[model samples]
Target: MEYIASEALINARASTVWEVITDAGNLTVWESGITAIDGELRNGGTIRIKTADAGGRTLRLRVQQMPGEVMTWTSRLPLGLLKRTRTFTLSLQAGLTHLTVKEEVSGPLAAFLGNTRPDTSQHLNEYVHAVTNRAELLDRAS
Candidate 1:
């Protein structure tokens, strides 16, 4: 399996951070490289995402959420050749929100496709910073 993860301590409540992450319409504002999202981010729902990294390919993901705590997006290749699951977890700590985003890639072809997978460490850091900045801004405004 391949894993990429990022975390941040934002000066915002968990609820506020959750709202920011779950708002699909404004996702592109904070999520770097994501060009568009075409569906709601509710549990048991599916959303199609267009990203600059994919070269115009749209990624379809299944959404799973645990309200203000966790949200996970899963995508799979045909015949279970590869599967990727990205999870966002939020927790309250010392009146602040602790956010963690993790992505795990696993399947029979994982080893074979290692070279083809993009290195997302930098992207993950950017994502964490973006979320923290946006959540803190909203927290201050409210």
Candidate 2:
């Protein structure tokens, strides 16, 4: 399996962070990479994600929700040949929220695409930063 994971300590409550990150309607308010997404964000829902440059892709993802702690989404890539899983986990540590985001690719073609595809760490980092910023702002307003 090929994966990318990022961890950071965000100065915000886990619940607040979770709420901000999972709300698809508010995604554009924080996330820079996504142009738009349609469909409800929940278990067994289909979502259409439009990126800024790469056009768009639709994913029928199976969501695993663990409120305030973790949320995971898994889906099969086009042709059902490659599997992709994305996860976000939060933990309370020393009065701060420890946040981790990870995405993994697996399948027979995983190694090939993993090597050819550009590094996704940068995209993940952007997501984390945006989430952190939004969470902080929301926390301060409350």
RMSD of each predicted structure? 1.2, 2.0
**Residue-by-residue lDDT tens digits, candidate 1, 13-124:** 8888999889998988765558999999999999999876676889999999999999999999999999999999998888788999999999998889666766677777
Alpha-carbon lDDT, every model: 0.89, 0.80
Consecutive 10-residue window with the lowest summed lDDT within model 2 = 51-60
Q: Report model 2's TM-score to 2 decimal places.
A: 0.88
Question: Model 2: C-alpha RMSD to truth?
Answer: 2.0
Clashing pairs in 2: none
Question: Which regions of candidate 1 are displaced past 4 Å?
Answer: none
What is residue 116's positional error in candidate 2, in angstroms? 3.5
Q: Which candidate leads in lDDT?
A: 1
lDDT tens digits by residue: candidate 2, 1-142:
8889988888988888988877989886666477787776675666666665444554456777777788887878678679988899999999999999999889877877745665578888888888888888899899
lDDT of 1 at 43: 99
Clashes of each: 0, 0
Model 1: ten consecutive residues of lowest lDDT: 113-122
